[model samples]
Target: MSNGVSTSTDKIIVDRSRSHRNKAVSKAVRQTRERLQTGHVGNFDRELIAMHISAMLQGASIMPVFVVIIAGLGIYFTRDIQIFTWAFLTLSAHAINMLLAKRAAKQEITSESARKWRRILILGQVLIGCCWAFFAIQGCATCEGQSFAAYKGAMLLAAVCVTAMSNFMLPRAVLFSFAPTVLALCFRVALTREPLDLGLMAIFVTAVVFFTFITDRLFQSNLKILSFQSEKDDLIVELEVAKSMSDEARRRAEEANLAKSRFLASMSHELRTPLNAILGFSEVMSAEVMGPLNNPTYKEYTGDIHRSGQHLLNLINEILDLSRIEAGKYDLSEEAISLLDIAEDCIGMVQLRARAKNISISQQFEPKLPSLWADEKSLRQVVLNLLSNAVKFTPQGGEICVKVGWTAGGGQYVSIKDNGPGIPEEEIPVVLSAFGQGSIAIKSAEQGTGLGLPIVQAILAKHDGQFILKSKLREGTEAIAILPAMRVLQSLPAVEDALTVGRKRKSFA
Candidate 1:
């Protein structure tokens, strides 16, 4: 049996314990949420900017194509050569925006750098807006009537909507992108002041306001999505760390327990040899086998030595038995055994002690019980432990009832109950644990190593059985050992029936 601490002390070993790591991750996520709820979105500005830039670039590939198509329509309707110049300038502005977006995507955008990039992208949008402004002011002079004015207003509205949808990630980028065109429309409307021109101006202003509101909403939604995803990732990492730490702790505990058991089990021989010598010498001296001791004090001392040595030997034996059971090395030499007879024998063994304590031992055995297919020695030990505990705990002149009977499942049970001070409800588990003594047991004059019940439990478990200890304060305690039904060995067929079966087999042959 080895005794050593199992905790690792190496500096390089990272303690990825779950509880601490989870707390840290939870704190970080909570802080992030607090910042967001407090209107402190600066921390996440970089992510917002990156999303805006990516969306702009994704749709950039088709913007120039859209510009060329619009320019072609304008040239056909107005018969104007200047539309070609407008298309070239608009495409140039779009190209510059795309280049800036690509450059922003390649850099590690921090919150501080995001503001600088925001301004640069807004400038690119303004340049595009100026091109649109020039187109809005051209007036389609070759086309006649209010129909031509409505066509120009519809085109400007489409341009505003497209800008709002594409640049929604960046704050104010959509508004600035079309502000120049709105100004140009106002200028054109003041010069003419026709009802149709006024209506076009009013419609264009409403479209800009509506689209800008929609853009801001989309930006908030995307920000929330990114926050939720980040939180989920952190939780997964924390849970994994916790699981690994729990597994490592469990493994270390098991290893330490096994080592302790091995150490105690290994000392059986070394311990018993000295105990045997002490018992033998003390017994001889107390009995005056070699010679009579003239001194009365020496005679009394010899007896004390013998008794103490016997107690020590018993304690060591119990420890070894429990250790062997824990180490999974306690083999059972099984046989056809009578539980009733074993219970009777154990009662007899404890009868002397019970009598010395002025306790009454009573037996209630069910007659004609079948033998059990179990280890006789183990059953005997289990019975002895229960009976001895009853005698030890029972008050003087108290009743100790021992019952052996068939179980409802056709198995068997031995119950030993004593009218003594019962164990506390909370202390029941404590007493069942190895080497654990309850409050009552600890204060009793008849103290033990507290291995008796645990050993009985282990033995019954090895026989595929259960040991139940039920107790309530001042109500006395009962220990019951129950063997499963499968271990009950029923009687075989009578000789005549066996002979008949054998004759049938021969006839078939």
Candidate 2:
């Protein structure tokens, strides 16, 4: 498929996937917000009821044993038969509560059903509380001269403590479970007006308040934990969605890149075949090799054709070079080469162009620099591209300074500086990108494919080197290509020293 069609298809796929993902995320977020909102109590109530029911079911079998044990002890202390009645009543209330929780758990617990079940459970707690109240108010007939009231108060406090710990999940149930008993204690203290009864009532009220506060705190903590867990689940879902979208984008990009590479690969041959014919035919016609073109206009037209074909061919070659480099197919033919010689050769090639423009070219080189292990053609291209750019931008009678020297890190560098209208600071990155020219370059009448600098940068990168471009508006531009120290092959010893060393090793052997 063509690049445009492939891009459109990828866009459609991405949009459809994003639309679905966005819808799902929005729905999830909306539902979570509704559940957590102050005005919408139904969802929150459902969750709370579900938790309470689970806790209630877990402690159901244990409640009866605890009731029997407490009642048996109470009977031994007070020697009253009514303790049996309290035990039976409390056990009945607990059984009713357990039945309600089981029913809620068995069915789907919606908000309405949760509210209804919570009320019924609280009522069961109140019934149990009334039984405890009766036990608190009853007197110990067989145990005279003993502190039975205090013993009753201690038992009531113990019951309150157990209720607080066990029923903290259902805060309302915890409050209602002990409210009646505390009320009965208050009434007993008011009617008797005795010091011991008043003191017991005081301690009982304080204990109830303390336990109530603790239950509320526990309830709040559970609420916070549930909220955090919900948020964490939401974040995990979002991260997964983002990751999938990223993977999809990367896959599409890779497909598009492959398509581009194939298209370029095919066009390179298709374009060059016709282009070479046009250049060859146009060269013959311009030279009047077949027959003298008597018309001056015909000769000029043939010359134009030849020049245009040559420019197009050069552009095609550059595009192919950049494509191969980007695709990592441009393997370097490493050999020991002199940076100074390469720079000098490139300067000589561009000397005619500089002379045509009346531009001055100066060279500076450090002597005795070591040879570098690199691809000679790629390095030559790098130096030539930089020189061509400098010559192109430098004005009439402008001076271009070229330098080759050692880098601070024991590497070699070739720098080409021109006294031309420099690029703007903001447009530096634009000029560096493929087919990206700065505003100034675009405005100028120069013909450029904007591939020169990018090709130079790519070639340097393949050599494990660096490219630096510094420009100031209306002042100048300097382009530097640097090769690392590892590529700088160190010089070997002389032949005589090597021969002596070889002879010494042979003698030792």
Candidate 3:
């Protein structure tokens, strides 16, 4: 009983050890197979495989013609039925292989499918090699004189040429196909036991080695060319995809902007109705048009209400105008207007506020400045917005300079400069954007809606003019609106005519 138990234990240990060893070997074999597969030509790109297959099909097409000529020669010389039979079989098999290769080239090639196709092609090549070997073995057996020697030479030459041509795509497959036939020829030549035949076989071997080297170089070159083409195709596809994404994003942004414009347009009337009522009632109460208020505080409160309502209404109007400009719906009534006149009018409009703030206003108007063809209302708004910003930002007792003159490039310009706390260079772009307030503006006592400069920019842009703002920290800010040269009206001749008419009238008087 003790012996049986020991035997059973030993058997169990042996079975477990055997199972573990088998598992290890299986794993190693799987890893090795995967490594070999990764390095195989069957793992080449699908497009490259298709290109090689197509090239092989073209070579195969020409091969049957060569075979027919060789077969005719063999029949005429040898008059042997076996040689003819083998040649016919070889031709028929090659035709079938060509058809299969054409079908494979047309099909979509994946890695596994490429491997299958390559194997089928290699098998067909080997069969053809076997037919050539049979022919050479039979033909060399019964050679008599120079005619047979010439025939054998022709066969060798044909084999070398076929191997070289077919191997351009896959050198290894061609080598496999032709090596057996060459070895068979060498063996037959060695059997002759002649010094000349041995010498010839050595030369044939050397030629085969040279042709193999050439085939390898050609295959590598073809691979590089196909890889570059594939990369170019990939880049083109990526660009097209990127362009499509960009266009989609742009289209969405436009739709959102249009929706915002519509919403602003629809709400304009609804908001202004109540705001107008508030302003009217507050004004009536502040002015005491109906009756006197018992409390002075009520009158003060009504004044505040009126002012706030007016400010709110102005902000709404500015927003609506900006929205219309962004939606490309702002219509301009073009007219010939004087830049000097517009600047003077804007300065006067802000004069009262400047005086209240104890800021001095200085003006320098260039004599005989040309008129500008522009929208009168929009141009007026641009100047007013700039002047208002200047007055609002300038400190008490600071200077505001307003200039109207010709630009250096023959255009007309209106420039407003103020000795205020100038904006920082980094903050300039921030202030130019709609509803964007800089840190300084946010901390100032005179709070604004932050839409003034943006409104000015939009209005000037509508007039085909340029609006530029230059500033330096702790120095000042200068805002210039320049009308383009195309909009500048030449007024020299008109001014001369007016002066002559005035002189004639004075003489007649």
Candidate 4:
């Protein structure tokens, strides 16, 4: 029975040994094949890989000291000289590799340099793997019972920690460093010829396979993070370039607009001089003040000439006004003035033209509306323009309503509404632009230069007031100009403290 048990035990050891050997060989083959299939590291990714390796090396530098301490303890407890020697050699080799890796990290890693350093670090990892294998083999060789279990546990724990530490670095380096040590451990345990040791060896082999899988996943994750960072940096650079181009284009546009304004300003005096002379001469000829024309055709021709000259002069004046307003050159002469008085005067001026078209004018003036601190000339012009537009657009017998009152917010407002074919809502912006007549205004017999509303808006802006135009198709159009409350003059309290003083002075006199 004893001889039979010995034979069975020996057979089990041989079978386990063979199984473990096959596993190690197959694992190595699979790793080699996978590595070859993966091809070379990308040129762009090489530096990142080097950086990762350098970081792992720096962190792993301290790991050797722990191994030395653990191995020294194992030697003290078991009195094993080989274990101490292996520990010392591993510490020395790891320290040297750490110094070299740190030096390499400081250098700028180009593609060529990265490849060279990768190979050197991998070779160092292989040497460290050999040292660990030696410790595991020699430490467990002479150990027995509880000492054997403790030493095996400590060495396995160290191997797992080392594998985990290297997971962030190149997978090839991790495989080269950890696989050999783990395989040697499995082989050593399989030689014990005991069922318990063989089972433990199987567990170790399985752990190594699982660890390699985890390391591969970690390596792939690091590559993904690096790739995303590179893409983000590239997008940021592109956005900066686009923003710079947009700024340059905007600067050029502003310069061109400034040049155009300057040109218009410089030519204003020259253009108006000839226009004024033409109007003066045409007016004299049309009125026959110089002399009576003998030909009736000449009289009619002078009338046409006078009207054309007047129209041209008005257009030029409107252009110059708008240009000066845009150039910030229109100065206001402000005074305390009554808005009601100005509205009345403007209505009176346009009443003749309105009556000629049979358009009835109506007024709604707020009783005792406050006076405005404003530019009188500009205010008068604003009112006149609104009144003229209302009269011109209104058909025969159409009614025009002009109102001067306080705004809801306590400001003064002048509103003019005309019962005419109202401007289309979409064309309101066009009519408010310089020389941008609406389709309705262009079709009407009273076509204007289209500068009226823009001028009103500009003048109101200068006064810190607001101009609002509201109209609907086929309904009447209303234009409102509001002066802010700050511009509305308020009267002082009359004789609150001075009433008694005035009465006493009267009695004394």
Tens digit per residue, CA lDDT, model 2, 11-106: 111101012257876887787676555322123677887988898899787778877887887777877777888888888888888887788899
Model 2 sits at a Cα RMSD from the real structure of 10.1
What digit string (tens of lDDT, one per residue) describes model 4 on residues 259-322?
9777776777777788788778877887889889899898888778778878887777788788
* Model 1 stretches with alpha carbons more than 4 Å out: 1-42, 51-59, 65-87, 129-168, 179-262, 291-300, 328-342, 361-376, 401-415, 454-468, 480-509
Q: Is candidate 1 or candidate 3 better by lDDT?
A: 1
Cα TM-score of candidate 1: 0.72
Worst 10 residues of 3 by lDDT: 9-18
The TM-scores of all predictions, comma-separated, are 0.72, 0.78, 0.71, 0.71
lDDT of 2: 0.83
**Residue pairs with clashing backbones, model 2:** none
In the range 1-509, model 1's lDDT, one tens digit per residue, is: 12122122211222121222578768877876775455422257888898888888778767887788888877777788888998999999999989999999999999899999999999999999999999888766678876667667777888887788788888777788889988987998899887887888789889888888898898888877777666666667876898899899989988998888867767777888888999999988988999999999999998899889899989988988888887789999989999889987887788788889888887777778789999998999999998888888888889988877766666788878889999999998899999999999999998989899899989988988888887988989998888888999999876677889899999999
Error of 2 at 287 (Å): 4.2
* Global fold similarity of model 3 (TM-score): 0.71
The per-candidate count of clashes, in order, stands at 3, 0, 0, 0
